[model samples]
Every structure is written in C-alpha cells, then in structure tokens.
Target: MTTRPRTPSRTPSRRALLRAMAALPVAALVLGEAPGLLGTALAAAPPSGSATRYTIVPFLNSDDGTVNVYQSDDATDFRLVQSSAYTPPSNRIRDASVFKHTDGYYYLTYTTHTWQDVSTTIGFARSSDRVGWTFLYDYTVPIANLSRAWAPEWFVDSDGSVNVIVSCSTTNDEWIFTPYVLKAANSALTAWSSPVALSGIGANHIDTFIVRIGSTYHAFTKNETAKYIEYATASSLTGPYTITRTGDWAGWGSYREGPALVQLDNGGWRIFFDGYGDGNYYYSDSYDTFATWSAPTALPGISGTARHFTVVKETVTGGVSITKNATRSLRSVNYTTRYWEEQSALLNLPVVTSSSATADKQAATFTVVAGLADANGYSFRDAAGNYLRHYNYRGRFDANDGTSTFAKDATFVARTGTASGAVRFESYNYPGYYLRHYNYQLRLERSDGTDLFRQDSSFVPATAWA
Candidate 1:
C-alpha cells in the first residue's frame, strides 16, 4: 500500500459477478429476500388521480452481448419488454445504467470494453424511445495511466446537472478502483468536465451508486478489501465522505457489489446488488431510508440472470412517440357522449360530454402499454399504474398482481370494430369474451353475436382528458 493519501483499488472477489455474472427478466414478485426477510409491497389500492408511472430495469446479460429492457409498475416485480433492446456497434455492454434526460431522450452509460481490456473510456448511447438506440460516443477519462474506467452511473443532481460516477484505476492487472465524478459540460451529455476524485471512497472499491435525500448525500460502494458494500455520507456531492456502516451494516453481507437503489411510491427504498460469488441477484428494502433493510431476496426470474444493472423509477406523459407513453380515453361507440371511467375501482361507462372537469377526465383515461402476458396484445393502465383487469369476469380496475393470471386478465387483443374507425377488445385469456358494457357497467362477457354486444364492446381512442 502506498502512502499516497488517495487511490482506490479493486475488490478482487467482486469480479466474480461483474461481467462474469451479467444477464436477463419480466416476472415480478413482492420484494421478498432470503425467507424471513421483511418485504414491502404496494398498497392494495394506490391513491387515485395520478398519472402512469413505471419502474424500468435495463441490464447486461451474462452470455449475451446487449442491453435488455424490463419494466414494472411496482419495483418488486419486473416484466421483460425487450431482449437485446440496444447494443453499441462494438465493445461489451457491461454495467449498463439508464436515465431519462431532461431533453426527452433516454440515455445509457456503460463500460465499453470487457474486463480484459485496459480502457480509459465509458460509452454512451441515446434513444428517443427506450427500445431503439443510437450510439453517442465514448468518453475517455483524462487520468494518466488510466488502467480501468468502469460502471459509469448517472447521478442527476438536485440542481438538474448531469454527472456520471465512474470508478477508475491506474493499474490494469490490479484494478485499484475508486469512484470519480464527471460533470456534463454540454446539454448533449457528449462532453464532460474533468473528473473529480471522490474523497474517502479511496482505492480498492468499485460500483459506487449515490442518491440524494433532502440535503445529505449517501454513498453505497463496494469495499474491495472487505468484499462488502459500505455506506458513507457527505454534505457535498464530491465528498470527504464518512463511512458510517461497514461490516454487516444493513445486513447486506460480504461478496456483494453493484448496488443500485430505487425509491418506491409507497415511500420506501429498494437496493439491488449482485451476489456474484453465488451467482445470484438480490434486493433489500428500507422503509426508513437506508437505516434499516429487509433481508436480501433473490429477484424472481431475474436473480441469476441480471448483473450490475440499474432500475429507474420514472413518470412519463404525452411526449414519446410510443403509443403507451401517452394516456388515452376510450369513448364508447354506442354511447357517443360516454367514456370508460373508474369509480371506486370499478370499471363503468360514464357520461362525459366534455373534458372540462379534471375528475371526470382522469377517470376516463388510461395509459396503454404492451401487454404484460403477450406484448403483441395491449393492456390498459389506470392513473395509479393499476390495470383495467377482469376479476371473476367482472370488469374492475386492479393493481397488477405480478401474476400471469393478472397479465392475461388485464390484456386484450384489439380487433377492428363493427363500426368504422372504432376498435373492439377481445380478452386475451378468455378469447370469446369481449369488453362489453352491460347496464352501463364494464365486464368481460362473451359476445352474444348480437349488434348490441358489438356496439357495447367497441370503443374509439380519443384525446387524453388529463
């Protein structure tokens, strides 16, 4: 060890799950970890009059060579949207983290080369839609004798500035990694200010993810020597940080790295990490911020597959070209003045001659997203991110139970309406059942092959009320 007073190095053991453990998911479950761990789930019903918000996880697959996109209404259960959604023309897509920029673009920052390469650069790609990506550029760290630059994660500051926290080392064979900060010099995010070394997160650490709550900055980083993630705090973004929790702190054990945290709408936080030594992915929850955590649980379907990826909780509206990004109101074909509405969680046809009142408008609007069971079909999501699903064949607005049954119950295949310029929805699971309203109440009933059923089932997508 040098008395250089600085320089962070490698967690030799953590390399076990680095690119070595990277990989793949769409199934969601409550945030449960190792049995007996406390799990926090969404409220049975979310507060009404909200917009559609989703948690998106973009990750690097171990055997594959691309970034995969998975989405969730709740942070616990994830639904796979795209496999190999985006790939840079060259270089390995490791430690890929995604963030939506202020300019209406989804941006990705990742380690450009595989672990074997001595690299000074982190790569970036941009997409107007999360599905299609165009390579932006590779940013070279200005460090002399830069041995490795890895896990460039976006930390958009409270002040709206964009910065990437990347760990760097001077020795290639010996990855002496410490987290460094690079501020975006341009709105394009292609250019950056010179890297600033993070104080106290000294050598032998990697994959540092930081989040700001109120005024304090909490840093969760891998302590290479201990092979466990440690928590640190500082007043400034660049810190002479204080390591508050070390061994067994937060109950997240040794041989863990790639820490990423996402805040839940329920006022809780979930931290995800790679248990590389065991080739598993795990997550823990903290209701009182990072002070306490639930036991680490294997991410259902995703635990063994995904490595070192970040999950972003974002609220989107009326901007992106993806039809799902925009919320729409379904107008009944038979009742021209009426639209679909949710009243006390029940789906009903309500008369709304105009989009004049906010209450009336929100009840009639739904966010349309790819079907949870079959992406080819469509699912209708309510303001609180719940789905317009059928329960016992009765139309009801319910939260995604993170079950295939719920996905199927919620999904509907669109068919040409009996009337021109309208559409009828055929239930995805019960093929014969269509979303036809009876007694002004929405329900999944089999078409009686009557004109009444056709008109009742058919609806036209109109402007969003909210």
Candidate 2:
C-alpha cells in the first residue's frame, strides 16, 4: 500500500497530533433549529472565528460504491467536495465511516454486503490524504452463517487500542444483530483478533457506535424491537453494558437508528441519527453528556441523501496545511525540486538548486489568505501584492481588480492529493478544474481523470522561501 511521505522541512505539531483520533470528528448537523430542541447551547462557527472544521461525506445506499466528500466550518452546513470521490472495487459502500489514524492517514470501515445479502465480511480502505483510496483485503468475520455485518465504526480506546464495533446478524432474517468487537493487533489495523461478542449488548441491536467520555464508556445503539435509540454505558470496551435510557428517552420518537456522536468545541455533545421510518435525518445535542438531551432537530438538505454514513472534524492545524494569512511556497508534486515562480505575470515551474538566487525564492513565496469569493476557500497573494488568478484558464500573477469575476477566478479549495500529502487546488468556479502545470507552465485545467493529471495538479504547500 502506497502512502504519502511527510515533508522533511516540517511535520504536524505534537499537540495537534495528540488531539485527533479517527472517531473524534462527528455530529451537530442541526442543533437549535428544531422546535423541540431546548436546553442545548449553540457552537461557534469554525474555520473563520473558531479553530476547528467539520465535515460529513455520506454515501448513498443505492450507489454501487460511490462516496461523496464534504466540508464545513460549522456543523450546521456542508459543501460537497466531489461526487463519486472514491469507489471501492465491488459491492456496496454503505455506512462508510471515517477516522484519522495516528499515522496521519484516513481510514474507512464499511458494510461490504447489501442489507439483504448474507454478508460474511466487512470492507476496509485507507487514504493517505483523504482524496484517493486504496482498497485493502476484505476481512471475514468469524461468525457461522453470518447474515450481515453492518455499520462498522472505528473506536480507538483510551489505551490506544484500535477496535471496530459491528452489529452482526447470525440469523438468515437479518433481523437479529448483536454487537461484536474485533481488536486490531497492530497500529496499521490490518491484523485483527477474531470477533468477540459484546457481553451486555444482546440480540436485536444494530448500528452500535461507542465513544469514551472521561473514564466512562458511552454506547449509543439502536433497538430493532422498540424502534428507538437506546443509551448504554460500560466501564470496559467489551462490556456487560448497562442500558441507561430506552424507548423515546430523548423524545426523538420511534424508528430512529444509526446513532453517532461528535464533541462540540464548547465541550457539548451532538448526536446524529437516521429517521428512516419518516424518511428524514435528525440530530440532537447534550450539554451534560447523555444524561440530558435536547429534542430531535431535522437536518436540512441532507435528510434523505445521507441515510447512514460517516463524517469527520479536526483542528485545521492538525494536518499538513497551508495556514491562512501566512506565506508559503508551492512545491510541485511530480517535480519536488521545482517550485511555482512568477515571471513577467505568468506562472511557471522553475527547478530549485542549491545555488538558487534569493530573487527566485521571493518569486516562489505567496501569502495565503481567505478567499474573496468563499471565505472557506483560499487565495494567494504574492510578494508584489498581486493575487494569482486564472485568465482564460491560464494562471497568472495579477492584481485583484475588485470585480466579482476576479474573486471567483482567484479563489481555490485545497483538496487532498494522491499519495503525496500535497494538496491540489480545485478552481472555485469550475468544480472539476485544477491549477496544473503543462510543459512547466501553470494553467487551470479540467481533470481528465488520469494519473498524470492528478500528479500534475498536486502541489505541496511548503515553507515560505521569501
């Protein structure tokens, strides 16, 4: 399996690295908007005033294997990264849950088989930068006549042991599913111990997701019989779990499943669940853990599209990133020795040497700023104070003329790249187009879905040379 190599000049900060776990980024899709939602506090907006960023990429159940990526500053709204962003080789990609490993790569655990099919295995895939994914071998769950293994979620315990909790159906009806744990033997999560049955969580339970708060283990699972999400707690990973609240405990009504939780920046908890019976999606908040929760609030726009899926949230400082308001150099992904340089208004790739001139370094440096068009996006300002924008799809260093067109042309969204930890800048107005080098000249071009195109468009946001 290929992975991106970290830049030697700098790595992610120690604090940032320690703060993130794969299961940490989740929920709050809707909090205070719902009528019954009371006693819950609103979280501050992120990536603008706050330091955090929220994202949810849900896969359609009908999709053969497509997974769409999303980005958001606040948990309230989300923007699609791309459609069919990544698809596994075969079967369905249902409940594609994601989390960032300590290795700095994003990993997914998914339901490989359809709900009706007698599935014996779960799907696994890993991405270096969350853009391109490489499929690993399918892991067979050790269950006799296993009808289905659905909603596999990543759980990194306090002891740092990576485990996956899955609801397994041993019956042919697929109605009775018991939660099971598969412990990873190594950091890579490739080798795992045989499935061990969860002690207290018995039959007729599915979509079991667990999170640890303080020393207590909180499990939010669905009861197929009662048609309501039940809350449980345990002192250990595999617990003699105790059900604390059951049957409309949060007033979410019946037919609620797929319970997931995310910790807000305010230290509150946001839980997302699927209102499948009503054909909608909802979220609720709890300021004091799950002891007390607000009423269910329906999620806008994503009510039907995201039936069962995964999301992510982390500090922007955690990953290899180009900081806004800071100066940085763009190093070519395919040509690491070359940097983007401005000469006579046009952008070009110039090879860097040990004896590279100071003037050349100054031309390579650009100050990263919030996008004039979309604040969540970014724009580059050069040493000469000119913004780099596309003119007739050609990249150039030109002054911002303060026009609406100029703002759109200058804005870009940095997307995770292919196997290089570098980021590719997708054009703001043109979704599939990227700033790429052709014959060493920079231009905005539409992706032809080629490896050469991905390599060409990708660039590392390196330390500023000037």
Candidate 3:
C-alpha cells in the first residue's frame, strides 16, 4: 500500500504560507489573466531592441506537485510562462538558478526538495529555448558525511567552463550550511568535479550568487549566523575569498535572505531579496560600489508571495548582443590595442592606447540607444546624451546635440558579426560604408566586399562603460 507524505512538526513561517498561497491563483490575479491563458495571449513578438531582459521564478505548485515557471519583462510585472509542471524524480524544485552559456544553451539548476527536508541531490536541465527544458542529470555531491544540499547556482566562466555553487550541510552538524563549488566537465552536464567547500569549515553560509566585476569574482551570500547579506571577492572562481563587506543597508527590515543581483540598463546594479516576513521582494541599488546601498524599497509589479527568483539580461532576437541603453567602451577590431575614443572637445576620433593617461579625457562610453524601427537600426549616445551622427553623407562621424533632428542621420543598421560573438555597425544613409577605424581615427568607409572590411568593421563587446 502507498503511504501518505508526512508533514514535519516544525511550524510554518509566514513566508512558507505565502509560498503555498503562491501556488494558487494569486499570480493570475496580479497579472490580471488566467495562468493557462498566457501561452496563447503572449506570443513571441520581436524584442524592442537588440537584447531583452527577463526575470525567471520557479514556484512549487500546491495542486500539481510540480515546479511552475513565472517570467517578467519588467521586474514588477510577471506572467505564468509555463503552467505545465516541471517535475524531477524527487517531485519538488526550489531555489532555481538559470544561466545561458556561450554555447547558446540555457541551463537551469535547482534543489530537489522542499525547504525543510534534507536534500541529498540537485537536479539539472538544459534547453535550446528557455520555454522547453530537457532533464540532463542529477548531481550528488561525493562528500560522505554530507546530509543536505540547497540553493544550487551555476556560472559559466570566460574560458567556457561551467561551475556550480551550492549550500550544503554535513551529517555531523546538519543545522549549519556552508557553500561548496563543483565544476562541470562540459555544458551537457555529463560529469562534475568533487565538491569543495567554498566557505571555511565551520562558517555558515547559504543562498550564494556569484557575479563577475572586471577580473574579480564576487560571491554574495546569506550569512545564517549573522542574519544578513555578506559579500566576498576572489581573484579566481575557485578562490580563497576575502569578505569585502557585510550588514544590511538602512531601512532594510531585520529579516533578509536569498540575494539576487542584476546590472541595470543604465550602468547601475540592483540587489533583490525577500524581506520583512511579508514575502514581498525588496530591492536596493548601488550606483558606485556594492559596499554602499540605497534604502530598501519594495519592487513594484511582482507578486508579494514569490521567493528565490533570478533576473538575467538576455538577447532575444540578436545572437549574444550587448545590453541596450547602457554605456560601453567600444574597442576596434583593426586596432586591438586602441579604443574608439571621443578626443578633444569636438566630436572627432583619436584612438587612445592607454585609458589611464587622461582617464576623464578618455571618457569614451557610448550608450546603444534604440532606433525608429526596433529591429532595423540603433543610435549611439555619449554620457551627456549627445547623439553620434553620421554627417555629410557618411563622410564623418560625430556626436551631435541636435537630438531628433539628427536621429535619422545617426541611426545605423546593426549587422551580426561573422564571428559568433562579434557585431558590426553600418550606416543607414550609406549602405556599403560602415563605421570603421583607420589611421587611429573613426570614419565611414566602403566595405570593398572582403573579410578584411568585415574584420575592420567588426568589434568585440564593450567590457564596461569608461
């Protein structure tokens, strides 16, 4: 005879009750439509710009015994993208993390049990498109003394290697959780390296999320003992990390957990987490550094019942494109050592070999503003909001303050790169000629119908806004 599932003796917290209520029609009411109706109502329209932003949440369905997918364009508003149950062998999924790798596949990793249980395994899945996912493998950490695993998050390194970090507890002391790192053999999730403890032996850490700032890897984690969010940084992914900062910012309530971070379209960073036992997600922004944060505010447009969701900026139409509306430092294909510099007070080009000689004078940050037709073209803008215009019949390129007057002249068709991750900008007014670098300067020149022109016109993605 089949036995009924046992309910643990521990009292359910307010957040736990909210999570249960989230499996009901609350999301439908917040979205103002039936959850099942979303599949047909929201067709896959072309994204506004070259890239699209998405927030992914995996919620446990109380009715179906499966994990449901909720997605949002703006973090505030959400829709049930996948009403179909995502069921693994363990029949539960929580703390979901999704990553789109350089190999052009989406990978999702999650814990296989509810919050109270001792989970020994984590589930993995892969998808060509984010909508449909296929189960890949379940990873069981090789630690003989380990008792539980929770909140697994994976990152794809610059070298195309995949690494997963999870909160794990040992059999000796099951109450305290520490972070562990596991390296995958490949994108297919075929094999994994033995788990290595990321935190010190007795340190209690959970809900870890890793992000790369320049060459440094910063791991933001929930300190179980301190009851606050703390960040640590390391030179490499596998690290002896140094705790850089700790403590919740002013106005954040006593209880905060599950830290998720996303870089905004305007060169700022926002950190999100559940706060105040209300089940609503609160957010804080850091304009300069992660050390200091603004007053916590309830993120608008999200369900008050959601928890442990992740937001990632993705390219919907274009293949691996840059984030739109953000300032970026563009480097030249021909002059690999030089960058497209805004030299002098005027809008003339002078390639700079070193960004440090006159750092402010080397302020070459250009924002990729959208064009008239969403898919047709784009315009580049300076930090002061001046439009970079191709004037005099594609004869020269300069930043013009004329706004919409030069918008048509400033717009250029964005061509996909011949290489997988490269992109080219071609003039709209002049078809053959593209924005290219020559003699350490910017100019519009004819392609001459060769790979060299494509190479000269091509550029690697901007590292960060100068």
Model 1, total clashes? 20
TM-score of 2: 0.59
Clashing pairs in 2: 22-100, 25-313
Q: State the lDDT of candidate 1 residue by residue for 317-392, as single tens digits.
A: 3211225556888889988888999999988998986645888788888898876766646788888888888776
For each candidate in the order shown, give its overall lDDT on alpha carbons: 0.71, 0.71, 0.59
Candidate 2, lDDT over the whole model: 0.71
Instruction: After the best TM-score superposition of candidate 2, give how far the Cα of residue 69 lies from its true spot, in angstroms.
Output: 1.1
Where does the lowest 10-residue lDDT sum fall in candidate 3?
A: 28-37
Q: Which stretches of candidate 2 lie over 4 Å from their true place?
A: 1-50, 61-64, 317-466
How many residue pairs clash (N, CA or C atoms closer than 3 angstroms) in each of the candidate models, in the order given? Answer: 20, 2, 2
Each candidate structure's TM-score, on Cα atoms with residue i matched to residue i, is 0.61, 0.59, 0.58
Where does candidate 3 clash, by residue pair?
Answer: 76-300, 76-301
Tens-digit lDDT string for candidate 2 (52-92): 55656567634636787776433534556667777878887
